[model samples]
Target chain A: MTKVVLLGPQRHVPTVRSALDDLGVDGPVAVVTAGWEEREREVGELSEHLGCETRNLKLFSRSEKALDKDPELLDALRALNDRMRTLQEHYRLRLAHTMGAVRELVARRGAQEGALLEEEIEHALGAVHVLDQHHTRRTADALGTFDERYKPTERESIGRARGKVKRDLSPCAALLVAGGHVAVLATRLRLFVIDQLIEERPVVAWSAGAMAVTDQIVLFHDSPPQGRGFAEVLTDGMGLCPHLVALPHARHRLLLDDPSRVSVMARRFQPASCLALDERSRATWDGKRWTLGAGTRWLGPDGTLHEEAVPA
Target chain B: MSLAIHEFLANGTPTPEQIDAFLADRTIPIVEGPEVTFLYRGEAAEVSLQHWIYGLESSREFTRVEGTDLWWIVAEIPPKSRVEYKLGVIHADGRRELVRDALNDQLAHDPFGSNSVAAGEGYERPDWTLPDDDARPGTLEQRRIQSEALGQRREITVYLPARYRRSRRYPLLVVHDGPDYLVFSSLKTVLDNLIHRLEIPPMIVALTASNDRLHEYADDERHGRFIAEELVPAMEQRYPLVGRPDARCLMGASFGAVASLSTAWRHPGVFGRLLLQSGSFAFTDIGSSNPRGPLFEPVVRFMNAFREAPGKPAEKLFISCGTYESLIYENRSLVPRLQEAGMTVRYVEARDGHNWENWRDRLRAGLSWLFPGPLWMVYE
Candidate 1:
């Protein structure tokens, strides 16, 4: 079991400095900055803040090289992503109309009409549920097909990268993961399986880094261009955080004031607390228990939000 | 086709009921019209017709009918031109109010003021946004705050339920353009009615005023710092506001909206919610070069800088703009950027132009959605 701490944004204040101090592990740090995309190499400032000999796992570059070396793997992965995008687009349109109808119906309540409206609303809600299940399953199936066919684990380039990543981690005591484009970050982490490479060493991650380590990556935006606001699932996460879905910068991204929206989000991701990763918020999993930080909140199923703190 | 003007008042001095019916029937605008005649009911007090289409001084002086004390004004108007107007009544005492048609109930309000609205046959007033009489009203408590952030003193108005208790905590709504909302939109009344109907939760609203609003709201860094460090803290000491960052919201219109959004982005710890109405979020492809204008330079610079790296998202944001507003396209474009930042956003558009009235009308839906209450079960 590895010690992992999920953190808030580090763009301005670098809250990670205090979190690292709390971890108290003294050694060089390995980083996964793939989320930065092209700017992944700019870890100089990060190294200065961490005060450690930091090295990029370069998983982003390695993934690109691996895909280049294996044209068949590249085509298969490209096809999977394109197929996922098309399915996602279709699913989004259906969801927007359905959710709009459901919300409108839910708002109607008069003695005779209330009962009739509630029934129709529930029916509509059920349809959305069924649609969600279908989308999630189809997405997994599409990605699973590529993995099953390519067996990228057995690929020569990827295997070499994995070996090098493991060797690179040998001298490191912990891992530092920064935020960027979550899809890019999640892809590289999946390909390299750096979670396995680190193997019980402490890990510190923030923003999309925290989201990537969770059980599912949910893409949500209430006010988006061209359509109504509805949250959707992008893909599954690495399941490192456990029984918890981390929403980094939730203060900036969630309609926490609307109980209906809050409750729907909490229930949609049931069994896991929809934790809001506001500024200076952190969650440390110490093998057995979780130590939540100040300013953290979880969306409650009862249409309420409660702030969280580490158990005394 | 011209619809002939036909109205009846009692042969003697008209009864209040008779006057009401006559005025209601006659107040409707003439559509499919080359010309139109408006009827006003009064015995002898000089009545002047002030219209949105024609300014106050140019109001048509009413002519008394030969037989009855009825007053009539005639003017040439285009078809489908919906306009709001008021009567300039000099009751011999010179005491006057920009009164709604005493007999007509159709009214429209903005942050500036409200007026009696008459729509051409084809022009439909958005009746849905109007507040109902039976809905409960909220109370406003006024105070003056000395802000160190901007080094200026300003008035802050806090709104709470009519039966508010200090023991219970409520979510905080920090609204910009406070004075305008109080005079024009009747925001306190809207909150009261919404809460009474269970459309939205009984929350505390802090209406913050600005001295140099344009410069302060143009993505001002010092203004952003002041909100986070001073204004919010001072308000907490005075009210039983919800302390959770997520429970708080920053709302503004036009430039004020720009300030709210930029402040939230810069200091994510202070506020979590944003309600932007017709925000001037101007941005350019090349950094620091804004074709929008000198006034929009700061907002353009801020948006451009944000593009370098997306900041943390706020909780849920409710954004709206009038289709007729110049900033509609800009507001629409900001939607995708906010979503990409992983923000939950609610975008609404009204048919009217950018004015306090359109923004005021949207308060019901936007506020109710953002802060739904225990009474949220009722439908308007």
Candidate 2:
């Protein structure tokens, strides 16, 4: 039951506030974005209008030269990989140890005598294996595929990049926005944060946050004159939220200017349900039906309004 | 006073015996000019001096020579109440540099920026008794349900001064995060040490436990009320503690620090002195729905409010922090703000983290400042 609102690009502060008011959510919001002084002022203005909190959340980017200069990040990445390998080896050794212990107990005492002891050892080993696998998978998901192009060379650069990771991890929530293939990198970082939050506390997400939770991300913007706004190769998302693909700013001109094009894109890439959210719209799932909120409307492939009822 | 001139020539060396005699006398006469000349062992040495020396204290510069070799130069520094000087040396190669003294142990940092100094392994634990025995009468367990307003039962520990049994009244220091402060910082031991030394006046220490720490410390007024209405009055009634604002002080660390500061600022008449350590006054975004929302900027509003309410019954503040603490920068920034508002503040930076080591170090200095030494000590 993690609540998230993915605001569309250049959406007014009041519009976002309206969405939050409709949801009956409180304030003290953390704003995450990129850019320089001007953008920060804009963010401040937005925060003032919304009566919440905002901070710069963007860390690593394809633009930052430090990423190219720093070798510490690469070293950290290698270290993380080495640690993961060691953990796997240790897990195997533990399994071997538990099995050996069970064998010893069985040999010393007959099967009838050592049955309870053996069962307890098996349960412990099973729990350890489950935990080890979870950790291994999480580490792998966080690291993702390293980019050879952005690999750092200098120690300071590497340290700065490492610092960025620490800072990103330190915050309770983060929002990452990317326009190119870098989105994959952003998704990986988001997944790492999600995995971290799962182990400790709850975290909320929005557009990219929602996309990070999904299995795959469908780029719904057409290339000015193309048929539908779907990317050639569909990229996998962080998969934090399972079985759902989130389409934010559903009513924005860039994505919804041509309904037919969006419809075609939706048909080509069908999610569990097309969550088309407008500026003031919201949809929540309570492990049951998709409870649609105000400012949101759903549609079918036939271009007809689907059954719309006020979610109670 | 006649300026002694034995060797009155430039670039001449003096004998070791003559230099020793000059130092033994510990008296150097002033020679007025842009530069000064001094005589020793038939060799005249000229120094570009700005000050002169009188007795143990000095102001002007002087050079010395020992036998055939030139010993280190000595400056006649001006007399000041506090000893403060840095050696300016002109080397043989005509290059001038400040002489480095290994014994110059005074530590300070750039007033405008942040800096850190190293400290050795900190506080060690001593054998202390805990009030855990259930059979003991008039213990914390017996006085558990003192107030009905507090939803849950909690143990409050109050420490009266050594002369509390005979004294008619005593000042009080109400502290939050009672268990952690009392255990980790060894609050009782520290209090005992301060009182025994007579650094601070005889006062009672009230330790109040925080049940919901985060909720109470999140810059809320309701949490302030819980202390003012429930805890303060209850303690006053139980102990021979002073109820007036001037005699009462509030102390806390981390989130508790923020709570104490906020409480003191809101009701300065209720609590005069504030001891804030590693307080979280910076902006946070954890509990907000909108990432860039205003509710998360309560600290900004709080700062603005504090700025407007400059002077009051709260006459003194003792703010301290560890160099490595996360809120070091914030605390550093807060000092000037407090000072600018016409409040007497003592800021201390220790070489540790946001833990007991820093707080314990602060306790002695803080107590001495709050309650200065007696008139006899000042005269003596």
TM-score top scorer: 1
lDDT (10s digit) by residue, model 1, range A223-300:
422235677767777777677777776765678888777877776666667777767888888877777777677888
List model 2 lDDT by residue over A81-151, tens digit each: 57645654564465445434433443454546567865654464454335444544554553444434333
The residue ranges of model 2 lying beyond 4 angstroms of the native Cα positions read A1-312, B1-154, B283-301, B307-313, B373-380
Residue by residue across B1-380, what tens digits does model 2's lDDT show? 23344332243554566555554553222122211222222223333322111233333455454444332333332221112233445556666644322223332222122222222223222222222221112212123534444455657777765535533567778788766776767676666655543346567777876766765675677667667777788778877776888678888887788788877776667887878777766643233233324533565456445655645536788889766555787788878778887778998876456555457557766766665522111000
DockQ of 2: 0.00
lDDT of 1 at A267: 67
lDDT of 1 at B61: 77
DockQ scores of all models, one per candidate: 0.02, 0.00
Worst 10 residues of 2 chain B by lDDT: B133-142
> What is the CA-based DockQ of model 1?
0.02
Off by over 4 Å in 1: A109-130, A308-312, B1-380
Best by lDDT: 1
